[model samples]
Target: MKLVVRVKLLPTPLQAAALEATLHACNEAATWAASVAFENETRRPLELRKHTYAEIRERWGLGAQAAQHAIKKTCDAYTTLKANLRNGRYGRPSSRRHARASGKPVVFRPQAAQPYDDRMLSWQHQAHTVSIWTTAGRLKGVAFTGQAEQLEVLAAHRKGESDLLFRDGKWFLIATCEIPEGDLNTHPDGFLGVDLGIVNIAATSDGERHSGRRINRKREQDRKLRSKLQKKNTKSAKRRAKKHAGKEARRNKDINHKISRRIVAEAERTGRGIALETLTGIRERARLRKPQRTTLHSWPFAQLGSFIAYKAKKAGVPVVYVDPAYTSQECSQCHHTARGNRPSQAVFACRVCGFVDHADHNASHNIRQRGWMVWVCGAQSTAPELNLIA
Candidate 1:
């Protein structure tokens, strides 16, 4: 349950230069340290952090502790990435050749607002709350990552929280606060089921279907502007190019959050489980059709699933990811197997039983049934010798 809140780091022009400089120095230090570790032991020997920090400090003319933190940060990254690979949670670690991105590298945490890790980073919070990082015993600057107020704000808002600290160059303020959650078990009558779709974003088991059209006018306008910027020679193009990558991510995340909230609120009345497609090969299969590639990725199936999962958990409602097999093709009435049952985009009429229904509605029913089977019957379908979704 961790969310990054980005804020505007309102550093004065001079302060911005210094901050950026320090960050570059840190990144360079990390790169050098990584190089040293790899060269010293090509066999993946355990890293030794003892005096590397001291050595780096002497070479970079920074404080000794910064050097140590830098090397430690580099090692921690390599190790964590390695661990993630082992756990099947991430891809292979990056080679030095492919490394990119900005921001100062840290061992475990950033150095700015570093003292918060130490239980003391001076901060001011009267009205708009300021998170001040300390340097030479004076508070330095605040973080502006995104809705993320300075980490220090959390300390003031959440009393009895630990003071802030910076591990590498990152500031962190811990908050021990309790936000009210309305009683989740308040009602047990109303129930709603949802089915994620390809053309339509969602088709509820209850006849409500939501389309996945990008309807935010401002976002659409921004995208068009970005498209225009990407063509001609201008700084705005580069800036827009950079910002454009983030737009899709942010847009999809926000939309998923809203959609998940609506679905959760609908189901919370019954304390029931939400039904969702497992979404295994939706992308691959959908992409087999040229027009569907954009649609498939635009659906943000993973984010939608994740949003539903967390929201359902926080509420007393649970979510069920059914097998998603034949959800669209299987006849809801006679359990008939006929691809022709789904005659068109909006229609599903069973051939074997002569039953008729909207395609999305029939799919929704199958999803709900499969979810119930999984949740209540503890039924898991056997894996085939060769599994293919198409």
Candidate 2:
């Protein structure tokens, strides 16, 4: 598993200026290289190497590796643009043409974070300092501070390339570390089913529910705050609003992390895999009414699912996705399929079998059953067996 640990850097005034200058020069070179590469139709690094690598190095006064990394980054941007164009991802020519145009690329804060290899960056644990290469030459013993877990990762498994980023008036070194995968555990008791919904963020087949009412209330408050801020139309008001946005986002993400951790721990303790609904294109397919569209779009289902997946993987817990079609409408008790089975958002009652339960709870049970059929019964069936009804 690969994880990034961000450490705060405390550089001297001179070192900070040097770092900023180096980033400015590097990004300027990158923008120039990107324009040239786009014009000459050069997409490959090797192709750029043969044509313009040395020229850029000499012209920009950058070190050899720094120049090469910048050009490679530009090539990557162009590759993505071309791929998107080919796939018809962009609707407007203004967007497409702007992406492909040989215009000067925006250099926000001088693109100040340069990629660091082993040659360019080193860390000292005892002294709590890092040595990094800069345009002004070698910068050694730059002090840094981080949490214990972040420090531990740097001490142990820090590998590959790290990036030096300057943001919010502080310098940070983002280190990428590789951790070994865990052993897989057998789930003899079958899977723990999880149903994701708007009202309750997640409900397990075992009747555990994580309610989203608090999140919904917070979002509504944020929406009202944003509306008031937008009316001000002043620079400071906009800045304050942006700051609030970041705080809210971090809070939501932290909640998701905690929830995912608990869910994964439960699965691991019980020796069970997790079963989830495959919700690809759910927004477009659901055809939600106007009043519900905003809430639905802002639900963050994908983010929550991703958090669960990565945490599960780290703990060696298996996760499976079942087709979501009719999962809510189908009866978990007697396999009865009818739209009327789910008469309300919060309730599910089967007309045929007289079964009643919480809507999300019932859906989770159906999801677990489908997962069992796929994994154990050697059937690729998504639909519930209707034989019981007849």
Clashing pairs in 2: none
Local accuracy by lDDT, each model: 0.57, 0.78
Candidate number of the best TM-score? 2
In model 2, the runs with Cα more than 4 Å from the true position are: 86-88, 92-109, 377-390
Query: What is the TM-score (0 to 1) of candidate 2?
Result: 0.88
Compose the digit string of candidate 2's lDDT tens values, residues 22-115.
8888788877777677567777888876777888788878888888888777777777776766665664556756455424432324755677
The true-versus-predicted C-alpha distance at residue 91 of model 2, in Å, is 3.2
* lDDT (10s digit) by residue, model 1, range 113-153: 21122233333444433543222223355543323343443
Give the TM-scores of the predictions, in the order they appear.
0.70, 0.88
Could you give the C-alpha RMSD of every candidate to the true structure, in order shown? 8.0, 6.7
Model 2 score (lDDT): 0.78
User: Number of the top candidate by lDDT?
Assistant: 2
